[model samples]
Target: MHLTLGLHRAVRHEPSSVATFYEGRTHTFRQLADRVARLAGALRTIGVKTGDRVAILALNSDRYIEYYLAVWWAGAVVNPINTRWATPEILYSLDDSQSEVMFVDSAHKSKIDELREGSTTLEHIIYLDEEEKPNGTLSYEDLIEDGEPIEDSYRHGDDIAGIFYTGGTTGFPKGVMLSHTNIGVPAMTFLCEEYGFGSVSLHTAPLFHVAPLMYVIAQLFNGGRHIVLSGFEPAQVARAIEERKVTDVLLVPSMLHVLLDSPVVQKTNFSGLRRIWYGGSPIAETTQRRALEVFQPSGLVQLYGLTEIPVVALLSAAWHAPEMRKLRSTGRAAQENEIMIADANGREVPRGSIGEIVARGPNVMKGYWNKPVETETAIRNGWLWTGDAGYMDDDGFVFIADRFKDMIVTGGENVYAAEVENAIAKHPAVAACSVIGIPSHEWGESVHAVVVLKPGAREFTVEEIRHHCKDLIGGYKSPRSIEFKPSLPLSAFGKVVKDELRAPFWRDAIRKV
Candidate 1:
């Protein structure tokens, strides 16, 4: 089925129902559909043909949702730019995708000239702001006002729907090409399982990310209301939840951490919230415990997946209970997805044996855009080999150990950074920490840790940390070196950037992982 089918259904059955809520403004499904059709007509007028790429660089808003449906309605591909990326990274994606028309919001308008100057193919720039149009850009309102409403293009099944760019922590970002079925199927499955009709969902996470996009799609499938925020701020999220009576919301672990610590969140009434969906990175046990205490009424659900294969597995709300034993696991694979632990030769590993986590399902992307060799390497024998190191138990619970590339080898023994980081995070003094392998003459590679202490916590020494970890993990897994930092570098999705931590230590090494 077409991804835009949900929009059509919503407009047909609930045309007068509220579709979106943004900063005190509301739009009904009828209004949203009318604007979407007009925007599609406007895009077509500007030479956006079937399969052509249209990119949006904007924050979360009603207009952003309109941009998505309008692009699909225009028979074009949606390429949402990562809002946190640098100019060079953004330029690379636009140039690589050969996107012709770009949409810029007020927040990013200052960089428009530079982006346009650096682009070789970008032709038109549409301004999506409340103010008057910029000198060289077309007004978003003008397009909707002047253009005529058009019918849906009906792009379905294998038609390329989106080109989501992964955060390039190790190197340049590659665009993951997803088809309409690739995204729509999983969305429908998720909606059937979790969300009910007319649920009120909040869009606090960046819409550029696939996780939020999937949630948005699920809401659309259920004919639910969307409550959008420009960006994730703890105060604003809490306010939106209480004021909008938001039933469900998605957040990364980092955002959850900030929310749990915010005084505004503590003061806000969380009784209206029914679920808190979090993922993108592992949640520390301490942070999870605090979250459970802060949002007592809301059930927490953890999701695990990548841009290539969205929504592979989900740790259900039952597992988030304080007494649950499977809290450390990312959770079993979703019903629609098939996951397995594979050895280097693409052989399935024994139960409880750690190996590369591979997944196969309709949700898997077609391939990486313009990167044939990388696509071949990623998807072999119809399975998307996620570079995550993990294992499944006899009962089918999946525990993610670490990224295969992030594994630390010391004296021929494998040490997963996540294991050591988990141990360090248990300490009351520790707020955040990241483990990496550094060049070691004695052991080829040694475990090193960078730690961020909780505010007003006493200073901790390397020996103290090693002693603390010795009781929890193997002696070899203990961090040999420790450095205190206020914070660790994070990717757009909140995963620790291990490459940055290893850069100085491996600067003179013969090889870098």
Candidate 2:
């Protein structure tokens, strides 16, 4: 189940096809394989060994593609640093993973000196810029110059592949030990599904993020070309889709929303795009329907999965069901895994009953790196308790109520803040919204909504908006108060930072400690 079996298969079938496109350069499988081998050999020369950790701090570039195969070829663990993370978080992950070598792109070169200084496990830093290489860090090109194509250190399966870091309740990043098999589950799902495959996939999501990386790995296995961009900009995405005749894309709700509203998006050609997998947040039905009208059948699918167990469920184009177009449902258990909604005690809940959503599958993370207790708490009885609150319909479709952590308990009733937020978001003027629980004197915890208004809207009061929401949802579910902001804080993948939203209120609060 190692990547080579697939890599060698790809090389034999189509060696000359463009596998990666970045910075106006295309890399064929033959060339990529060669580079990966030589880089792995060079890493070995630098004393990298099996189970050793190598980290990559990069933007979406050709070297980033090489980073994946090279680390796996050397049988070393990969820890991809989040571009959005601050230095302290990045330092924490590097220290925790015990990474020996780190590849920092030109964009992050300035921080390399500081990051490397405090990392006891880090032995070397390689700068990955095509033209300019920093002085202190070794050049990526120099290291690969005519290095021997060393034999692969080991084949893959349950072996450690990547130390993928995701946010935690502890407020520190936890490295999720994702094996080759773990990634392969999502890779195989898209490949075998017969829908997600294409000649080109618009790589708008960051490659370091596991949710997006799942598609990148799948594209490689399927011989599809990846069109990489430095970052997500609506103009770039629209232009790339037209220029490359891009056929599929994985986009967050924010990007999708921005693109749909951009003039370039409407004017630019998108005749070739066959699939658009929108996720990373609860997409409003109004927006989902508008997308379908714009792109037709190609504008299909609303997939739901977290980095922890990314293969939660997939909604096919057929299920887009123009009529129903249910926006917030996360779909059902993926064909490869079981998704269960259980009570706090972990007993399975019946259909249509709301509870905590958990999953068990080959795709689940092995554990949090070096934190057995945290691992045990997350993956009890081989099930990855996702901490999302959702329920199954008789049709087996999973409907997400809200995250268990995001569920606001006000007074005695458990109010799903998402229901209230949905009511608020559906308003014509509301562009984006996040629901949170703020401290309250009477209710103990009162529902609060932080909202962003669309451009061109006139000033509106919070009471006016709260009154509009009460018309749709129950009064109790309506936000006790609304906070206006230009935009909600978002992660690189565009997930709302609920933790950051509540940080001020929670500064001295003891929550489940």
Candidate 3:
């Protein structure tokens, strides 16, 4: 089936049902389908065709939603731009994808002239904002009015559907080539599992990221409505959920904290909320505890995956056991794939042994776009090496230790960030924490942690934090030093930007990330 079949199926099932609550507009599936068709026709009129790449640089607006469906319906691969990125990064992805056309929202519309000046691959531009291009460049709505719905170019079963670029702040980004089957398989995996398969999903997470996009496609395939938030605001999210009776919402750890602490948490009715799914970063027990208390009716589900795999493990709704609360472990693998830990030799490690996590499944991406060598290094012998330090317990639950990049090797001893983060999280004063390896002359690399203290809590010194965690975990695992910050810099996915945090430490030094 074509990826666009989801939209068609939803319209057929409940044409009049609300399909999207975006910005100030509400749309039913029928209306959405009509707009998608019109927009697709418009895209085609502007020379979009099968296998073509179209970039969208916009916030999570109603227009962005329309662009998603219309791009696919036009038989083009959707390349959603990371709006948070600077001009150079945005230009990199657009140039890499060779996207012929771009759709810029009102906010970023002003930057087009500057970006377009040096760009060679961008042949056309369309503005989704109210102020159209002073030149004859097309407006988003006008393109829809100028064209007709072409036949459903159902590029299913291995045909490329989307080119999702990884957030490569450290270096150049690689485009993940996802086939129709890759995403179709995962969408069906959730549906077959009946984990709120077809329910309203709030898009507080950036739509450009894989986590939210996976849900957007999955929920759509399962005949669910999507409530698109232009951008995440705790109060606004709570209000939308309360007003729409939203069934499910996805968050990463930091956003989870924001919601629990928001005044809206007390005022908004969470009665309609069924489940709260979180991932992209480790969930602190404190954050989870607060979340459980605030979003009472909503059960928390954690999913773990990399950009290459899209999604791999699902810590199912079953693991939310009252007894399992303190374990801090991701549940057993989802039904879609097999999860195993591999050591340095590429051999599977025994249960309870820590190693790199690997998986082999249909849901995994085809490969990195235009990077054969990197793709080969990541996916060997049909298994994708997730670059995550982890272990499987006797119950088959997978415990993630840390990313291969974030693991600190001090005097040949491997230290995990998750371990230090967990230990710091136990401190009564720490609201959130992150551990990163900084340049150290004596040990090669030393652990340095940055912490966010709870409001009104007295400041603790670096020595105090190190002394506290020295006994809980290994002495070597304790951070060599701690730096208290007002807050941690989190990505759109809510994962701490450790590389960014540590950049100043290695600016002129010979150290590797």
Candidate 4:
């Protein structure tokens, strides 16, 4: 299936229906379709070809939706750079994907000169904002107005649709190649689940992330009205839901906590909300209980998956009941997915035995761009090894035990330990360092670093280490807490034992993950 098929269906069925809302502006389906077609034509005029990569580095807005649809309409692969990425990380993704054209908004336009110098393939920059266009950058409105509307490119099936960059285990980033089928399957599946036609969905989560991006695609199929927020601010989210009568929203556990804690939640009326789809990280039982009281009519759902495979399993509202005893589980596999717990030898482990979670389905990503070896390792025997440790119960519910991968999910964003370790290792006063996730009530888990100072070297402060890492990584990926240790625990193989570092912090926790 083509990624743009939903947009075509929506426009044909309800041309005059409200399609998107951002700030004080609104657009109908016909208007959105017309703009998308013109933008696609403009892209072609600017030398964008079918299968070429187009990148966008901007916050969530109505324009973000347009860019996503326009790129797919143009039959080009989208390379959405993470908004939280540092300049080097952003440049690396752009260069790795060979993106010829990139769109930037007012918040990120200041780095255009540096990005241009660092990127090997970047040729054009489009300013996506109401503000005056910067010198040497193309104006977003002028391009749409000047170009002719074009027909859909009609790319479909196994054709590559987007290249999403995710944190790498090797202290770099991996460009995850997803085909039309990889994204379309999940979008279609959502129609049979909680989302339906005419649902008013809120886009508070970052659009660049897979979870939020998939939600956008799912809404397009149903002709739902999208209420776009620049970012997730508790006050803004609560006000939008109350004013727009938003029916659905997706948030990570951390975001949910902050929103519930904010004073605005109690004052806002969210009676129109039908579902709260939470994922990206596990939620604390205390937080979930509080949510039930606050959002009485809204059902709580848990979506379990990663960027590589967007749809795997979903814990429905019923399973969240206190008597269900499956509240801690990630729920059964999706209708189209086949999931199992596998041992090290690639053999399926018996039910109730903890093992690595493995899955195979149309939702699985095609591969990592330009990394055949890593692809083979990830998708061995037609199953995508998730690197997440979990077990399935007799009733098919999957319980998350721990993570096998050297990764952390803090505030729903994946942070590879090696990436932070690599950054900290660059400090002049540090002799050795190991990064790990510590139990956090606020972020679910927080990045923590254990360092050993070099002999005869000046003692380094937490502020100094954080300042050094700011230029190398995102603020969220940097350590929130630091511990100075004499040495790190090592295994017989001489590799740092991260579990040992994480043990003390999680000892009294309800869940290990």
- Per the 3 Å backbone cut-off, how many clashing residue pairs does candidate 3 have? 0
Candidate 2 clash figure, as a count: 1
Candidate 2 off by > 4 Å: 196-198, 406-513
In Å, residue 494's CA in model 2 sits off its true spot by 33
> In model 4, how large is the Cα lDDT of residue 362?
96
Superposed by TM-score, candidate 1 places the C-alpha of residue 161 at a distance from the truth, in angstroms, of 0.6
Candidate 1 vs 3: which has more TM-score: 1
Window of ten residues with lowest summed lDDT in model 1: 405-414
TM-score of 1: 0.81
Query: In every candidate, how many clashes are there?
Result: 0, 1, 0, 0
Top model number, lDDT: 4
> Ranking by lDDT, best first?
4, 1, 2, 3
Lowest summed lDDT window (length 10), candidate 4: 188-197
Per-residue lDDT of candidate 4, residues 278-343 (tens digit): 999867888988998899979998889989998788888888887888888888898779999999
* lDDT of candidate 3 over 280-331, digit per residue (tens): 6555556766777777767778777776775687776657656765236766
Q: All candidates' TM-scores?
A: 0.81, 0.80, 0.79, 0.98
User: Tens digit of lDDT per residue, candidate 1, span 1-513?
Assistant: 688888888989999999999988899999999999999999999999999999999999999999999999999999999775667668888999999999999999998999999999899999998698778899999999998889999999999999998633234667999999888887865674567666899998889888888888889988999999998798889888888889999887767777887889758999978888877655566777788888887788888877889888888887888677778788888878999999999999999898989999998999999989889988999999988888899978888765665566554344667767877899999999998988664355678999998999987888899888765565767889989998999999998888798889878753342
Candidate 4's error at 388, in angstroms?
A: 0.4
